[model samples]
Target: MNLSLEITGLTKSYADSGFMLDNVSLAIPSGTIMGFVGENGAGKTTTIKSILNTVQIDSGTIRLLGKEMTDRDTALREDIGVVLDSANFSAILTPGKLAKVMRGIYRQWDQELYVRLTDKFALPMNRKIKEFSRGMTMKLAIAAAMSHHPKLLILDEATSGLDPITREEILEVFLEFVEDEHHAILMSSHITSDLEKIADYITFIHQGKIILTAMKDELIYDYGVARCTSDQFRRIAEGDRLAYRVKEHQTDVLVKDRRGFGQQYSGIMVDQVSIDEILLLLVKGEN
Candidate 1:
């Protein structure tokens, strides 16, 4: 498989907060979307910044489009389109002027594509970006990112401010982009529902450490949430559970196999788990 983005032993630390990305590693294959999930302060942005070389890394290797990341390689960067949580567009520039500015920077810039994307996103072409709402700014950023014909897109909370309809439209555009097989996306988002709808794989990070990475379908169909009393919980085999949390009256367990666990236990309820619930169980449960 061809990987568009690969990180090995990616580590970074901040002195102020003592927050560190501890030996983080993952890969996004071409033609697939990797959903990066975690709560606030879980090193999602830090990991991305380290990969982009915006912040200095203490140690690690980051490869983009199969080339090692280096400051001298502008060509490698041109192949990537990045949208962070906040876009820093010039306040006075309209969508028209922004297009002109980008054309000067990216050699592969497609003005026609930019125009079409702006129209599709319903962005005001003539209005100054400072006067636009947060959602409009985000849409403008996404338009700019896609218009350059990048091979890989790295999006950080890119859909936070948009309404449901707009989010759906933007997601459709993303799906269309990844259909090329030479294209891929690594999207870090709080919106797990969107990830559930679009992502091929899910990677969970907590407290600056990777908790798990697995296929989306495997997690949805094979993995399960097992509910049982304390006695039944103690009876559950250690090999079957990824993690388990005990409540006052019920013990919620994350089982590796839903149907298999049902057959093994006979009476304990083994239910399907969502991506969000998986994250919650993994983060809050004990191994």
Candidate 2:
């Protein structure tokens, strides 16, 4: 399989906070949607910035589509489409003017696709972006990003500001983009519900460390949250378990392998945990 991105031993640090990422390594195969999950300060955005060369890394290497990207190879950026929290647009320029500007910047810019997506997303072409609502700006950003038919997409909190309906719409656009199996996406968001639906793989980072990386479906099904009385909770052996919480008479345990435990603890009830729940449990500390 073609790899869209390969990052190895990635490390970054801030003043007095130690490394934002320590010995972090990840590979996103081409055409796969990789959901980057972390708490506010857990280096999700830091990793994205590092991949885009927007931030300087203390150590490690990142390769995009098998090409080693460096500060000198700015031209290589053409293959990447990035959408962050805000749109990279002159607030004064209308969407039509913005499209014209992009035409000069990207060699493969598709005015037809841009116009089609903008219309499909109902983005006002004549309105100044400054006057557009946050949702509209995001729609425009996505349209601009996809217009060039980039091979790789990097999104940081791109869906955080959207309503459910709009979020679903944007997700559909991502799905269609990767349908050709040559496009890939690296999406960083606290909104795991969106990731749960569309992401093919999940990478979780916490406290500057990679807690888990695996297939999204396996994450949901292989790991589970089991509930039992406080008395029953003492029955299971604990070592390398993911998470657990206590509430009065009941205890909930998040286990990595549910099949063996489920059969052993037939009296306990096991249920699938959402990405949000898994993140919450991880942030609270290793359980």
Candidate 3:
């Protein structure tokens, strides 16, 4: 199927409050970059953890590179590179020593790529990890993840604190990684601007549920931000495809079926929405 990852009927929860994820399903095709978009506490990280088997699932199935995923026997994981917010390196070790430790852990680790990336990022090899700044630490994590040459890369907020130049450099690396037509990525981040530049698909989650998911191009082309007075909003929003809505003296609406909405609401102004605008309207709305 050329699909790199799949999740079906995935469910997870805390003790008594509510489900962190509920019957969620996701699929990422090989060579595609899928952006996992959500606000804080929106279950994006939980879903990623479930797929990686770091957390147990209540009832569901996960397949990575066409193999069923389980908590034990992480052989499939060896083919995947993961970067979280923190590097997970020993604070006392130097970058060179950390490289050796990771090489021992992954059977397919590429030492040449590791060395090249270290040089490319211009990381100081002898400095302790604890001494590195936040941006430098993020670069180190990227270097480690790319060193393994994995088929799939899963990142959770990997670019939260980097400067513009560093973020652009990382984006270039991601672009180069997908050039092979066999690699894929699932990146979770609140920084919508970064995702807009590189992601091919977008998924939005709010309040522990998936609000929308689709190709990035289609989202930009088809969905729209509609602003109107309160009376105009009421008259225009009474449709099946009104994906979501927010109300003030003026209102913003997200319509997935843009053609249908356009036909129905000829009086309202509908403009193309960016990833950030879509996220803002969805997360900030009153349900």
TM-scores of the models, in the given order? 0.98, 0.95, 0.93
Per-residue accuracy of model 1 over 39-66 as CA lDDT, tens digit each = 9999899988988899999888998999
**Candidates arranged by TM-score, highest first:** 1, 2, 3
Evaluated against the true structure, the overall lDDT of model 3 is 0.85
Clash-forming residue pairs, model 1? none
Where does candidate 2 stray beyond 4 Å? 16-19
lDDT of each: 0.92, 0.88, 0.85
Candidate 1 lDDT (Cα, whole model)? Answer: 0.92
Per-residue alpha-carbon lDDT of candidate 3 for residues 9-52, written as tens digits (9 for 90 to 100): 88898887665798888899999999999988999989988888
Please give the range of 10 consecutive residues that has the lowest summed lDDT in model 1.
82-91
**How many clashes (backbone N, Cα, C below 3 Å) per candidate?**
0, 0, 0
Candidate 2 lDDT tens digits, 1-287? 88999999999988786656898899999889999999888888888888998888999989998887888886678889999887678899889999999999999899999999999999888999999988889889999999988999999999997899999999999999888787899999989999999999999999888888989998888888888787777887787266788867787788887786788888888888888888777777346
Best by TM-score: 1
Better of 1 and 2 by TM-score: 1
Could you tell me the lDDT of residue 86 within candidate 1? 90
